[model samples]
Target chain A: MPKEYDTFVDDLSTLPEGKELILAIRDLAPGNRKYDTRVVKAILASSANKLPEGDILWLRYQRGSLRPEPWRIKIIDEREGLLLKEKVYDT
Target chain B: MPFRDNREYIEALEKAGEVVRVAQEVDWDLEAGAIIRRSYELKLPAPFFQKIKGYPKGFRMFGGPLANFRRLAIAMDMPADSHPGAILDEYHKRAQHPIKPVIVKDGPCKENVRIGDQVDLYELPAPMVHDGDGGRYISTWHFVLTKDMDSDWVNWGMYRQMIHNSRDMGGLFLPTQDIGVMYYRKYEANNIPMPFATAIGPDPISALASCASYGVGRNEADLAGGIRRAPVELIKCETSDILVPAHAEIIIEGEVLPYKRVDEGPFGEYTGYRSSPRMPRPVYRVKAITFRNDPILTVANMGVPLDDADICLSVCGRTDIKTILDNYGFPITGIHLPPECSGHMIVVAVQAKYTNIASHIANAIWGTKLPYPYIVVVDSDVDPYNITEVLHAIVTKCHPVRGIRAQEFAVGHPLLPFLSLEERMWGKGAAVLLDCTWPLDWPKEIAIPRKASFKEIYPKEIQEKVLNNWKNYGYK
Candidate 1:
């Protein structure tokens, strides 16, 4: 059988606070791709870095050129969070 | 329709509140350019010059109003901070899978037609954009229609045309550019002058795409169709066999004759300076001038950095880079054509799956038309968008001797002031590609200091709690 595939955040709306999203990426990122998760984080953090108070920075990060893995950021309920939707386009 | 014509696109701009109309009479010389230069310096929306000093009331002029990065993104239906890489991604997605343009029988551009000796080039208000410019340039946003001598392929490109008089003007049909090469071959083989048509004030997307280096023989108009998600309506010109975008504000139909020459520039080019002393350039003798009832003149403020070079050419370079790398089967994580570099400086981030991946990326870039006069390739970990971060990767990951490779004797573009300044013009120059990847000799499991320190992490509950209380803590 093909290695059982797991779906990442199916709906970006359910993503929790900042630390939770980072923890989720840590779980998903493995071995050679360890640095990719960090790259995604920096890109996500930048959007919210200078937002006015309570303006959440919602963002998503995706891989590949065509269909970028849905990496999104939104300021939800005064908290910044990221939603990594799926492995969009494999290199 | 992708856009019915130039007027339709202008209407869209007006509707979006992205354009501001200056009703005062503006001179084509310093006043028009000053307004444009100010818009660029302020990094504001594109400017529309409603009145030209000598032109009629209805004869509109478009200037710096929509020239900056912010306005370009707005027009393309993207967010404000849409970087060059992101925009390139947009173009790449469209170019590879182009939505072919639909053909229509007639369009508004056909509303007015002038052919033969009646074509008066002097009637149009082609802006004398900069002080040091040799003559009034008519083709920054102007697209030239030329066909291949053998295969009969059509090429659309932005070549500079200057006004010499009512019937003639200096044109840069550079040997490297398709127009120059096509004209050269036709002049040599059939002993016939090359027929050409110039269009100004078409759709913003078409104007922007014309600035792209879409390889030598590729049809940019079709590529433009893919971006607009509809066909670019084209109408046959009155005097020439060439076809121009149907809605172009104005069309200059003419033939470039043999043994005809004029001194063209000393104009402020995109390199931020006058292109040395004026040199001999090909002349396009206008045979006819066609336009809609109320024709709008388009202006591209040239020279002194941040003009067409950054906004137009840089976007083209980045788009081509990403597409070229992907086509070469390289794991290019990202690419950036920073505005500061006049789009000639390219930084690439690639996933280093194997040894010499950096070199591979470098080779891929060098082999393409968008080769930056300077290139730096880095490990996927570095953010190509972040200049300081890219530099850090270069400093930390690269060794001077082992990392640097040079390609000598590359065909350089004349606009590259650096190349013209160099001693040898033909392939005598060299390009530096830095391999800023981890040393290939290192162990696969090598350990580096942990990047996540106490400052980088916090419990989710605590972070959420603090953010929720941000107002209570006195910071908005």
Candidate 2:
């Protein structure tokens, strides 16, 4: 339901096929921030539209708050290193 | 009779203090789902979200509508304090009479409409349930309406659905399910798109009726009416001829395209685990959307025990099994599929009429629609709903060797985690039957041992005296 999700989905859909890899990180703290289940699910869902036939590394963190960085996604193109990276969304 | 619609059902829940109205803003992203999950875990009242973070003021959502037996009792129009077994008995009795649904011109679901280019599922607040799920699940607790191609049979079932952009939705449609069989054998076989309609937040009985494991060709609408003890009012879908509950809060009319598939699943399931990995599944192409002015999206936050799916399956599955055994002259007193077992096990209490009756009961169950793996048969004196009583029978009366019968290569459910990869893919696994009833051949005096329960060990006069003076002698 967030604007960032739509933007991410668009980026994934338009990517060049078989050229990029993705690294998705989600924060799963023990406290209220544990609500990041949606962040994990949404990332997996957005990855469904990925045109690139590359590996996806899903990582979970226990860092207590700064929960602002609940989820981060980085697109890595073999030669370009990091292509598109988003570190923080609406907290 | 059950409540007329979700509004009436909610009122009953509210009066009984079984639901909480959440007035604060809650994010549909994962926060809303997290609260629902916690509610189920704690056996708390249902949560009605009056204010969602991004949605309109009136677009509400409900979480864990049937989280406990008390709510289920209210859903069935019984006292909120009724026992679990009593509720199950009431449901089983209602299932015996299938009243037909009546058609109506228009209803609350049609108060607002979105058609053609106006349809956008993302506009609704379908929450992302679990962290590792596929996407925002739009149809967790709703019943999908699909009719038979060559007959008048219409099936209503709750199949988990995920959003695939705007007009497209992906969901599980296993070839073994009723809708799957109809689509695979008839619609897809004939190369035709299967017309469908989905109703969210219908009457309490109707929503549960959709999830029941009834036989094919028997309409769920009729079963819902039977449960309500009154005819369910239905209205025609805008794009398709399919009928949906007139009082439904929201309705989406669509078609399942022939030979089309989309990425679905990895969502939280009733099995208390994340469902199957993301893979291509059948897609439903939305044609129209209809709803009330302030529609309430019913969310079935599946996972863990005592959730809506658990309550529905326990009561509905119990009736299905009990009916089958009764028809075969098994003399069953009760049959329960504990929501805790997540549909993998069933406990049956039966009077021993002859020798080795457990195998016949297992065979009868395997032939039915939903064949579970672990079946436990206890004496009629034992209450299947009481897990303590069931476990006692199993540990004491049942012989370690003679009572447990394991059947290799038996029928199975595809979602069970214990099955091998091959078995999960093909629905083949080992099943067992545990006979806890005393053998009829055992002599009355010496061979059969006496139970240590209060009813069996205490004298009638002493029991009466204890009960009569319990409060006077330091009890609460």
Candidate 3:
């Protein structure tokens, strides 16, 4: 069987070269998957401009943890914390 | 205050407490899409992701703006708590008088422009909205603006486009749709590329107008203007002569290569299924990608009920059926495409004045681009909007054989799950009109069965007394 991505690419240099890829900053961790992508986003966005167009590869790192069914994704917190961290406390 | 742009609409949603700002980063690879889908299912406020996982700070996304009737009502400048029926009436009334769009020199979409080789479609985070989709789609909630090659007619339609590479995208342009008519009949036949521009994250009304079952040559921009009761400002495209909504968050201008076909889709469409197969479709060779600084990409999770498409087609598809019937002089009191059926069925309440009126009604609906498989026509006494009334009529009033017409070779949508690949390709299928009205030519003195209800069976005195004494009856 083919392999599945369990963790995000921390080192972009190890990624395969010479093919068009969909670069997504994903985290395979549980609960923190939603927020964990932030550090990876910064990691990729920092170097994305320098990378070749066809070489951008995205590894969809779910690790089969989060809800696969779209309807199963729950929205529990209806608070201002969901907004910008600074703006939530500004006013 | 009225909505003129996507930002204005978001502001309106924020003011109404109908928007949730996701400060936490959401992955575009499916997690963001899941959140958007959940938002629709719960009938919650629009989810505006301020921070996408893969993109920079300014590039945000707004999903399911008109996911509920309340948000839809706000989009149309109506009361937030307006009933869905009244919202439909409001939309239909405004659609009667289309206000032509006004052209402007420059707009927000022109704020940041990348032309030719500078265009990288990946700069905007195109969400892979559903798992197992063929690729990331760029145009889910947007409208494709294309002009008729032979005439001055321009059409704006909601067609999905998937990004193939840095400079190319592909989408399904069905032959039956207006865009397909322009592309296949005029452009492809003549061996010329068709000029096209798509506006993403326009005001909510424009998106609804784009999905409406508009006849050929009926401009959606004008219908949008009519619904909003104000002219939609448009800006000239960079690469093409086609104009796009001025305040749109982003505009992708390109040309459809005449003979070029590319692999596209297996998307989870509005029918709550991946109905359309992954196949070769028309290619959009991107010439320019223009947008406002820090663009807001409108994402539509079109898999199940109460999604953006369902919320829109519920009103628009019903409007088309009712309008077609009214123009043909059928005495229809009300019509509804329930959000539950996802536009697969329509219920029409009518006064069956003559023989075979149900057939006429079915045929009228079938003639439109959006035809429902289940056409339930009941008597004027029934409420088409109420599913219980429609179900009761279908069970009791409809005869075994005579009252049902299982129509073959009816127009079928590509997104319909039941159709075979070949059938969907040819746009042909079967439909059944459940005629629930009593036969007009029946000879019996009391041929029509009595309907028992507070509105139908009870006398004025009894209904009044019961309604007046409801408090004493221990009913709150």
Relative to the true structure, how large is the alpha-carbon lDDT of every model?
0.63, 0.76, 0.77
Estimated TM-score per prediction? 0.75, 0.84, 0.83
For model 3 the local lDDT of residue B159 reads 91
Candidate 1 local lDDT, B1-476, one digit each (tens):
44555666666667766577788887765677888877776765567888777777788777752456655665466764677567667766876755555556676666677777666565777776775455567666667777676665678887777775556666655565667667765663476777788778788777777777776668788777777767777777777666788778888887776665544454666767554434455667678877877788887776665665577766667777777777778887888877767776788887778888877777777777444667888877777878888878777767788888877766564456665443222323467878887765677556433334333367778888888898999999
Model 2 misplaced regions, further than 4 Å = A1-91, B459-476
Best by DockQ: 2
Ordered from best to worst TM-score, the candidate numbers read 2, 3, 1
What does DockQ come to for candidate 3? 0.03
Off by over 4 Å in 3: A1-91, B443-445
RMSD (CA, Å), candidate 1 to true, equals: 24.9
Tens digit of per-residue lDDT, candidate 2, span A1-91? 1212211221334433443334322222332222122212222332534423322323221111111222223333223111122211100
Residue A44 of model 2 has an lDDT of 30
Candidate 2's residue-wise lDDT over B92-111, tens digit each? 89999999999999799999
Pick out the ten consecutive residues of candidate 2 chain B with the lowest summed lDDT: B273-282
Candidate 1, superposed: residue stretches over 4 Å from native: A1-91, B15-17, B78-86, B102-105, B400-402, B420-428, B443-476
